[model samples]
Target: MKLSYMASLAALFIALPAAAQPSTRPMGPGPMPVFADFDGNGDGRITEQEFIDARSKRIAERASEGRAMRGLSQALDFKEIDTHGDGGLSREEFDANQMRHFQNRPMPPAR
Candidate 1:
């Protein structure tokens, strides 16, 4: 009787965790990945000129739509968006960042 009770208690203890297990809530996808566009310098690193040029083009394009982006805001988001931590965003990073920004936004309630 003693062994049976002890075994039952142990089984109950083991099963409790499984019963109380947290729901598998999705964290959504992680930040986007980027690559170095290391221009054909053969040095295997992107140049400052390339970086500035890209920034300028983006500003021009987005600005035309009255979507002027703040440099400080972009930098803050850039630091977080560049998953590789290399301080520069590749095409992949830019696309994913845009995608997630749109997808993750809260939708307006139905009228």
Candidate 2:
């Protein structure tokens, strides 16, 4: 019984290192930023200025991490996403725009 318990513990220890290691495989394109990401002031709306600032911040973060910022280089601006022409974006408009843009992009084949 002592030998069996020791073997079990040894197996667990061996497996732990592997389990703790993060996956090296690419996680594919990152999630599209939503209105919340652009709503820097948490005001539940994204003005054009807020959109540009937030996008720049996001780009800087991804660049610093050496991450490929795919699907983010869309030609979209705040006016494009502000479907209602209200001069600001609502969550619904943002989500709809994401669906139209991000969801339609063809993913690259897995290596």
Candidate 3:
């Protein structure tokens, strides 16, 4: 009985470190930003016009902050992101675009 207890304790010690190690894989994209933040009229959906207006606002804010605006000037290709073929985008479609964009983007080199 004493030998068995010692073996069990040894096994637990060996497993603990492995379990405690942080995961290396990237985590899934979390919930999208509040819809009202983008959905201008509180209509619960985002139209292409609203999206463009919001993007323009964001670019202007970045420019005011003296941040680089190189990529912000271009318009968002709403058709490419509107996966459901609807005239407007639901919150899910917006979030999916965010995830796809992040996954496909090239990572910056480590310092």
Candidate 4:
């Protein structure tokens, strides 16, 4: 009886972790994946090299799709958004620039 009880407890411990594991699936199509992909070093911050590489990859993808690749033109202007001139952007700085860009963009006509 004691052996059976020990086995059941062991099984419960193993199953709990498997059940608690976070889903590998994305919650939805979103920019979080883009940010994570660009963070090549797993350092939670993007260096200029990582940024450029990611941009190049994205441009290629867009070209393959026969899209105009309009966004790439401004994405590499790192100096403008670097703010502190540090030559690298933390996630905060990157997101700040995105917010600024979104805020300044002209609204489309109310259709």
The global C-alpha lDDT for each of the candidates, from Candidate 1 onward, is 0.54, 0.81, 0.68, 0.66
Candidate 3, residues 19-48, lDDT tens digits: the string is: 999755433322334556678997888998
Taking the candidates one at a time, how many backbone clashes does each contain? 0, 0, 0, 0
- Give each model a TM-score: 0.31, 0.67, 0.56, 0.54
Q: What residue pairs are clashing in model 4?
A: none
Number of the top candidate by TM-score? 2
Candidate 2 structure quality by residue, lDDT tens digits, 1-108: 999999999999999999999765545666677777889899999888998898899788877666666666665788888889999888898888878887677685
How do the residues 1-111 of candidate 4 rate in per-residue lDDT, one tens digit apiece? 999999999999989998899755323212422456677897887788887787678667656555443334455376787787887777788778767665554443343
| Best-fitting candidate, scored by lDDT | 2
Q: Residue 7 deviation, candidate 3, in Å?
A: 52
Clashing pairs in 2: none
- Candidates in descending TM-score order: 2, 3, 4, 1
Model 3 TM-score is 0.56
Model 1 has how many clashing residue pairs? 0
